[model samples]
Target chain A: MIILEYLTVIFLLIGGFFLLVGSIGLFRLPDFYMRLHAPTKASTLGIGSILVASIIFYSFKGDGVSIKEFLITLFMFLTAPITAHMLSKAALHVRQPPRPDTLNIDQLENIRDRK
Target chain B: MLENTVLAVSAAIGVSLLLNLWRFMKGPHMLDRILALDTMYINAIALIVLLGIYMGSPLYYEGALLIAMLGFVSTSAVCKFILRGDIIE
Candidate 1:
């Protein structure tokens, strides 16, 4: 029981660290598309870690294992990438500026023009 | 000791939420604001779950679940609106 509590603490701390990193990346990253990548990936994993800790804590407390946290984690994993894709597509449709060194700039511009 | 750990985690998540809010407000582009909003809700969900653990109550889970569902729907709707200039069309 003591070990499980320690593990939960570790997981929660790691999740918090990743959440902070994702937010910092969101604020600091240049270009809309680049910023989109940060929170989508990092925060998803962060939340996943936190949820896992919640599941373990509750189960050990005799809550008979709250599956809702698991469901939320699964839902987040399934939807985060798709959300990022749609957001990027929207950014592209609106011609959100990209960093000058961004690759295939011409291709993206061509796609916009073709639209 | 366990309570202290949860408190520290909550504080970290709160700082993350503040940063996300800064981005949402300072965004020079629509997509940046939208992304910040999306990230904010996810962080909020994390906070709520942590609160649930801290309080030793399962009640907060429902609120977290609702936020998760609503946040995703709103984000997708906003993205669709941006992409097509009409969410329903």
Candidate 2:
């Protein structure tokens, strides 16, 4: 009973913290590829935690287990990486410039040229 | 307890949205703008989910789900278009 409240609060705080970290990382990162690293990892975890909080609250608040949050969680987890991959590939295809001295930039060049 | 936590969390999400918007506006390239837009939609979904929790109803869950699906598809489609001149092979 009381534990559920504690759990929800903890989850909400965790989610909020991660969400802020992700956005701040996105804003502060130096390169487009580096920037891609921020939101996909941090935001997914943030949203996952928040959805977990919602799932826990709703499951106990009602007679049946509210399974909708699971769907969103699963879908987010599955798609975030794919979206990031597509965006990065597109960036590479379009020759979106990266910060000078970016490590292994030649590898990216190889990929771009392979196509 | 949950009520106050929801308030605080929603505030955090709002601040994040503003940051994303700043990135979108000042981005140097189309991909940067797309990235910012991508981050924005995720934050929006989180905001909607937070609202549903605050209201103590799952009424907004459907909207959240739809946004999740649509955001993914739209982002992917845009990426595809930018990758190749045409979306279809």
Candidate 3:
């Protein structure tokens, strides 16, 4: 039981740290394409960690291993990348500006123009 | 001990929420704003789940699920609008 408690605490803290990192990345990143990478990766891991902790905590609470949290985690994992991809595609479609040093600018434009 | 940990985690999520809000408000482009909004809802889900755990209630899970569904749909619709300039066409 003590070990479980320790694990829960560790997971919660790690999850919070990643969530903070993701939000900071969202705020500080310079361009749309660059910014698209952070939350999709970091925040997904963050929330997944927290959900794992929740699952552990509830399972030990005599609730017979609540599966809802697992479902949420799985749902998040599946959807986060899809949303990020769609958002980036929309940004690219509209020619949202990229940072000046970003590579593949002309390549992307060429591809778009050919379509 | 668990309560304190939950509180700290909730506070961290709150800070993230504020940062997301700042980005949403100050975004220089429409896509940036949309991305920020998407991240904000995800942060909100974390907050809601933490709240549910802290409160020891299963009911909040349903609310979190609903938010997750609606948030994704709205984000996709907005992105589609940006891409095609029409959502339903």
Per lDDT, the best of the predicted structures is 2
TM-score of each: 0.96, 0.96, 0.96
Runs of candidate 3 with Cα error greater than 4 angstroms are none
Interface RMSD of each: 0.6, 0.6, 0.9
Best by DockQ: 2
Expressed as tens digits, the lDDT of each residue in B1-89 for candidate 3 is 88899999999989998998998899888888888888888888888888888988777888888888888899999999988889999
lDDT of 3 by residue, A1-115 (tens): 8788888889989999999999999999888888899999999999899888888877777778788888888888989988998998887788887888877777878756736
Candidate number that wins on lDDT, 1 or 3: 1
Q: Which structure is stronger by DockQ: 1 or 2?
A: 2
Order candidates by lDDT, high to low.
2, 1, 3
Residue ranges of candidate 2 with Cα displaced over 4 Å: none
lDDT of 2 by residue, A45-113 (tens): 999999999998897787578877999999999999999999999999999888889878778778888
Q: Give the per-residue Cα lDDT of candidate 1 at B62.
A: 85
For DockQ, candidate 1 versus 3, the one ahead is 1
Cα displacement (Å) at residue B80, model 1? 0.8
